[model samples]
Target: MLGAVERPQAWPSFLHQVGVIELGKDRIEGSRLLVVASQANRGATFIAQSVTKQGLMRSYVQNGNPPWLFEFFVNESSNL
Candidate 1:
């Protein structure tokens, strides 16, 4: 899980609800510093493990068993 100190100060609550397993500062070839987020439900068993990276926006999400902190899975991988 992203450490409280490392998490964005103004991050959306919904994103937090989705739950994070890890968030790190790594270098992705073309980028200076990339933030990779390992989601709580994005395990090897899940399907549609999707990752999208556009500019400063990078996201990883997967579709699994049930809803998270909301009625529906946040950042549903179905959209991927």
Candidate 2:
């Protein structure tokens, strides 16, 4: 079975705080987001999605607070 690989240096620091969620490399469409392909801790694959830096910033402003995307992604991944 494949395990979560070390995050790329380019990945944002915020990703380190999300515990153990694995993401795919490709973004959906031109949207600034990636698919949360699998959840390591849960040992389950998922179709949920998370946003990229630009998307996160958008969410941060929309949410009006910290934890920019923790809440949004913790539940289920969705298209941008």
Candidate 3:
């Protein structure tokens, strides 16, 4: 569960929120907003995707390659 203040209005905020979720960070904001804005399962999925995309972007910047292709590969591999 997340707090209200922890919920994000933009992409970066969303990403940060997800990081908090992953790291088990506490938030003073209510989780209601996150729940109301996005249903439980959807919100979780959105957070996961956002985090994965951010990870891919960071990796791309570090390696100087297309992140999307690598993202696709990783996603496919994960499914298998």
lDDT of each: 0.39, 0.39, 0.51
lDDT of 1 by residue, 13-44 (tens): 53654243232223234433234444544542
Q: What total of clashing residue pairs does each candidate reach?
A: 1, 2, 6
Query: Which 10-residue span in candidate 3 carries the lowest summed lDDT?
Result: 31-40
lDDT at position 66, candidate 2: 47
Model 3 residue runs over 4 Å out of place are 1-65
Model 2: clashing residue pairs? 48-77, 49-77
Q: On residues 1-80, what C-alpha lDDT tens digit does candidate 3 reach at each position?
A: 34423544445646755676655534544433334433324434554575587654355456654566557556655654
TM-score of each: 0.16, 0.16, 0.20
Candidate numbers sorted by TM-score from highest down? 3, 2, 1
User: RMSD for each model, in Å, please?
Assistant: 14.7, 14.0, 12.5
Quick one: RMSD of model 1? Answer: 14.7
Q: The CA-based lDDT of model 3 is what?
A: 0.51
TM-score, prediction 3:
0.20
